[model samples]
Target: MSMGRARSVVLIGMEGHLIEVEADIGQSLPAFVLLGLPDAALRESQDRIRSAAKNTGIELPRRRLTINLFPASLPKSGSSLDLSILVAAWAAEAHVAGTAKVVFLAELGLDGRLRPVKGVLPAVRAAAQAGAETVVVAAENAQEAALVRGVEVLAAEHALQVASYFRAPGAVEVPADPAQEIQRVTPGSPHAEPSAGGEAAKDLADVRGQAEARFALELAAAGGHHMLLMGAPGAGKTMLAERLPSILPPLNEEESMAVTAISSISSGAASVTRLQRRRPFEAPHHSATAPSLLGGGSRIPGPGAVTRAHCGVLFLDEAPEFPRSVLDSLRQPLETGRITLHRSAGQVTYPARFQLVMASNPCLCGLNVGSGTQCSCTVAQRRNYLYRLSGPLLDRIDLQVQVERPHSAALALQQPGESSAEVARRVAQARAVQTERLAAFGLSLNAEVPMNLLSEQLRLPSKEVRALDAALDRAQLSLRGYVRVLRLAWTISDLFLKDHPEADEIDAAMVLRQSAGVRT
Candidate 1:
């Protein structure tokens, strides 16, 4: 009997665990046994590895072979560990050495080629954290895996190259094509190509009128506040919502990594080539289910639209048309900025911090605005339409602006409105102010500040917040609404270059909060 060991990583959401792959060959029937609770995709890797070994000019001993993954209690899934299993089986047959400390991550083809896998960035990061110095991945994942510091990445195109690197006896060598050869990748290496820049930000200059709605968009961008737009159809609500990402500031390095990692897990390896600095914008259809928004799957839990929109925007157009359960599922993540999904396998938590933007028409007939002229819907119908969005969900939204249809004169004006660049500059400055003020509290935006922190560390004077206190007493605003109003006031103050919120800012924030009354 001979035994060989290798290493790999298993990713659970963005978290990863180092797994040891051990292969044992003994004098028994010609059969293979795989241990460790593996999902269906992983169970099929045995056939894939056997075919890959045969095509790579390596022969396996026709004896009983047993492969086991350590930490048997941990559920393993995906084909990313196929390379490590092949390596361990070969080592057990050829008596090869020196594979205990390196991590192998890739899918194996029947033709012996290596294929890229998703979550390489987070997997490599976890391996580096676990003290693994070297990681082998497919060429397509080289740039992404190299994003992690303190790790050497070996990019290979075929299983033979990795076998040769490990000095396995009788390994075949292919033609010396530069593209297929093994390449070493390191952090910030010039050899890795940069991402093809994404589409240009949509400019706000195209918008005609609705200055109040534009200002609300600015406040939402600056403070990371949630917003709702209520109006008739063709009132430019969708256009305005689409332009929100244009005015938001680019993500910092740490934020970029977090966003890129989540994107990789959700999309795949091909979706990301480098750390993306732009914030994500996710717009799911009204047909989307609660699990799709909250990240749940039949077997493995995956990131939902909320997780994909982390540090970015989650725009829900036709918000009232969506199911009430789906809309209300966002209540917890909106307040806590994190979501935990439970399945029979286990539970995984992902960051759900994002700016929420919902656009809705005033009534089912879409004619309730502007004196309710030519309206055909009953009073109960309009109320029920708005009630689709529960009061609790509406309270979480900070800016509830009513977007009126612009006049023909405003649309016909030849001159364009303010450009995205100009608005983004102001948004960036306001964000900088919030970052500086909240650094001590381990927060970044006005929307993220806790109630206790607002009451104690950054409280307003009694006179400045007198109106809000009165509203709380009158039951016009809940305790949560009062805290949100305080946050919006601070954001308004930052926008106008005020050191602290004053009475003017407080009243403006309250007006924005109460603009689109639920009872309307």
Candidate 2:
């Protein structure tokens, strides 16, 4: 009973490890010592803990102090353990006599102030999952922890307050209702606007008219297809890509969590203070590297732009400006819908099922035969630049649009074209139709419709079907491209409320597929 000892769980990133805090009080020795492979930050906790306990009017036991974070094999990191270690030592020194009902998870400041700890939300949820009953955390992080239902959390601002709560019984003030804060929701939605990777949250109305371009954007979202927009510098390429998210649907609960998880692990990036509501919109600069685009690092591997854009849109303006290798790195995630960051700690796979919207010029000079201006770039330079976007990558893009400068009339005729909500209504309908069609096969959208599904399940009418066969033969469309066109056709038909693509839809889809050829 003379030994000062308490136990708590230590969280490292998303992982949790149980730690034992033991104290031996004797007249012989008067010093503090911590063991169990503590890192620099954890080791320095000695000063913070002592100062915090003293400020809270509790004396630090000077006899012999020992702390042990169990599962000694798992590397212990961060200051989330401060609360637990403090509680354990206090309970032992005060001789609480068989007290064992609560657990602590927080960081303590030397001033006795309770500070918010990173990844505590994940840790609190993990505790509930592991069947722990009571969790006490920093008052600052109560709201985040409260999101995990059925877990009773006690939040305190100072060490003194936390100690008082355990010694007595009272309704300690905790996080308030987060819902009361009015959020800038995507139009017509009853949810908060998401920050990390989201639907532009911007509307299509701001963009001058590009009727065909807007149509292409709708088709891209409907079919779950990647697109390439080629035009001169002044053309509406970037605007169209930005508006792509407006037509796209918002993320579901699971998708939101997946996005939050990757954002949480991003190095040098702070954890998301709240769950994002809108779909993510990431437009990395032309200077991004392959590893930054995908995922890799020296100590802890984190998700790249591709994974960060999971369940959202990844916009690459000046697409060709990105190094050939960087642009090519996306090929895997496009097909796999996930990216794995291989590190010495092991590979961490993050979800990357995002819609790709890429924009590039028709030539190196930013002008070409299609540009309203004269073409001045030499053929060799154009060829070299175009060649960079070879078959391996071009084959993946389902729709190719030659975005052009808006006509004066179109630009002036902004009669409030459409809000993200209106277009989202149609896109959601098309997605629903695709979901029903592919339910048995577990596919979500037309773009994901495998070649086998086209040939075997959703076969086209014989006459319209014959047209596709002849067209593919003459065009030499690869098997993958063939599937892509059919998927696009299905989406076009769905938009028009048709059960299947008619001959007209299939023809139109293929033309959109092969239009403007490659950007080169």
Candidate 3:
């Protein structure tokens, strides 16, 4: 019997585990058996590898072929192992010696073409972490694989390319630097691309009025606070929510890579050519199930809308229209900034740190606080309609502003409101101030500051503290609500370039916290 081994990575959630693929040709019946805890897709890779080898003019031994994936207890899924299996089988037949030094990650086509697989960036990172000197991926994934430093990447278009490299390891060529490749394709600073839904990117200047709503949106963007916009049907709530990304600052390099990795895995694309610095925004429909919103699958836990909006914005229009169960599932992630999905297989934690913006009508009839009341709903109906949003969830939201329809005179004015650029400049300044002040605590925004840290480390003036204590004495704010109000007060202070929050800033924060709709 002759045996050969190669390496690949198996992705479990965002993490990757190095897997050894060993192929053996024994003196038995001419059959193939794969041994490992493989999913359905991986169990079926034998035919793909065989066809690709034959099409690439490589002959496999006709004897019984057995492939074993070491660390046999790890559950391996996906077709990313096809390239490694083919390489190991060929090495066994060819008596090659250097296949173990490199990691392989690509799907194989029947025509011997190397197909790109998802999560290539994280997979390559894992390989580097495991001390692999080189990685082989499909041509399309070369840029993504090369994103990891300290490792050489080889790009292959067909199985023959990999075969050639293995046949003469010294003569193989290295792929181009990923930085250069990315710059060639995208020639400027990272920016936000149009959303996948094909909606034109909205701007803040489009709205004619609702200055209070606009200010609330800016504050939410500045502090990364969760907000609720309550208005009538035609009050431009959706407009303000959609334009939020434009006013938010672009993500830093580390955040961009993190966001890109999540998006690449979710979309099954190995590489993101245009690495966007703009924060992501996901808006799911009200009919979305809890699993779809929170990310659950039959076997592997998929990323839901909450995860996709990591380091970005998650907007839910018609917030009260969603099921109470679905809304309640967000409580844990909101407080912790991460979601741990537990399944029979295992548990995976995904980043769910996002600015949540929810919009809802004041009542079922949508005229509870609008200019003209044509409502026929009773008090009980109004209370029940708004009560669909639980107190716990409402308490997590820092700003709850009332959005009103534009007046006739305001709509008729020719002058536009503050453009997104102008508002984004102010937001950026506020964010920078917070970043500098909170760097010692390892926090970038006021909203992310823990309640204990805010209360203990941050000191407010005596007047401001007295005002907040008075509000607390009145039973207007819950314990959780009080902390959120303090965070908001800090954000307001940052915006005005104040060293600390004054009494007026505290009052503004309290107003923002206790605006319209049902309060916690």
Candidate 4:
């Protein structure tokens, strides 16, 4: 009889837990018993281990082998543990040394090949945090695993190679297959590289009209504020939304790490070799469901659109067409900047601090605004269509701008408005001012400043806030709306290089918040 142990990691959303694989080999009838709260996929690794051993020419004595994942209460899933289980069993049977301190993270192919697994970055990071000295992963995942500082990473292609590392008896090198040498594209890889022209190609210059909407977009990007655009079909609303990322600032080091980790886990680690420096931009279709928008699974919840857009923009074009439940699912994340999904197995929270931008037509026919001569919808239909955007959700959006169709004279000139690079400069400058002003409170954006801070230490003179006070007294804006308008006024002041928001800034904020002619 002999015993051996190895280590692995199981990721529950972005959080990873270290798992110990303990194998006991006893002289008894040939049987393999895996004792851990493994899910369906993990329970199937036993057959894979047996097949890999046979294909690799490794001999296993016909005896009772029981493997127990310590802390048997934690539910384990996925094939990531396959390599560790087989290695632990081999060490017990062959008396191989030096596996207890090494963490193995990979799936085993039926042909004894090591396959890349998802979440390798977080898994390796967790192992390093758990004091594991070394980590063994497939060659495809080696680059990603090496990203974690202070951990030794080993690369291997097949189970034989891993066995050889431990000097296991009967282990031999497997000849490489020429046919398998072709480059394999990783899942979630970017479809195309950014244009050589960079942000200039996606520049706001391409959007020729709707100057009011352009100003709102700049304000939204500058302050990290949520915005709503209401206009006709051809008013450049979608174009404006698509170009928002161009004007936004790149993520800082901490935000980049958080975004890269989320991307690696939600997608696959293979594609994310380095941190994602640019802010993410996610635009889910109108037909998306609540679970898809909010992140869900049968067992373990995954990151949703909001989480994927952390420190970036989440644009919902044709917002009214989305199911009300899905649109409402964004409310919690909008306020808290994070989302916690509870599942039967466990609950995991993901960062969801994203700037929201929603574009919608004024009514069902989408032509009720401006001339309204081509409109076909009735008053009730128009009201109901707008009502689909719940009151609370609408209140959460700070800037609501009406996008008017550009005049023919403006279109004839073909002169581009302010370029994205120019606006981005102003946005970055405004952001720097906010970061310095709010540094004492641990905030970097005007939108994230709390209401108490705005009302107390940063309170404005009564004359400057009189318009907002009257609007509040008349119940035209809720308390939340009142606070948001205050935040927006501050952003306007920041953009104009003012020390404080004057009365004109407050009035302009109210105009943008109400969206002038658009009905909320």
What does each candidate score in C-alpha RMSD?
2.3, 5.7, 4.6, 4.2
Lowest lDDT block of 10, candidate 3 = 180-189
- Compared with the true structure, the alpha-carbon lDDT of candidate 3 equals 0.83
Name every residue pair that clashes in candidate 1. none
Candidate 3 clashes between residue pairs 3 or more apart in a chain or in different chains:
none
Q: Candidates' lDDT values, in order?
A: 0.88, 0.72, 0.83, 0.85
Per-residue accuracy of model 4 over 1-520 as CA lDDT, tens digit each = 3888899999988888999999998899999899989888998999999899788777556889899997799899999999999889888876356788789999999989999999888898888898988888887886677667678778788877777667645644434443444222222234212212223337898888677889999999999888999999898899999999999987777887788788888886466666677788899999998878888887888899999999989999999999998898899999899999998777899899999999999998899876788899998998899999998898778888889888998898899888988999999999989998999999999988888999898899999999899999999877887898899999999998899998899998988988734443
The segments of candidate 3 whose C-alpha lies over 4 angstroms from its true place after superposition are 95-97, 168-200, 370-372
lDDT at 176 for candidate 4? 41
Clashing residue pairs in candidate 4 are none
Q: Which digits, one per residue and each the tens of the lDDT, describe model 1 over residues 31-109?
A: 8899999888999999999999888877667889899999888999999999999989888876355887789999999
Given candidate 3, what's the lDDT at residue 54?
Answer: 79
User: Model 1 scores what on Cα lDDT?
Assistant: 0.88
| lDDT comparison, 3 vs 4, better candidate | 4
Q: Which 10-residue span in candidate 2 carries the lowest summed lDDT?
A: 180-189
Model 2: per-residue Cα lDDT over 1-520, one tens digit each: 4564555565543344556566555565767677776777888888899998877677676677766565566656678778777877776666242224455777898878788776665576667777767677676666555555566766677777666555422323323233322122221233212234533367887776777778888899888888988888889788778878778887787776566655555532223455666777899999999988897766445568887788889999988889999988899999899876777644566678888888988888777845336878887887777777767888888898777678889867767677778888999999998898888998888888777778887887788877778866786576677777788899999888799998899888877876656731
**Which lDDT value does model 3 have at 179?**
33
Residue-level lDDT for 222 in candidate 2: 86
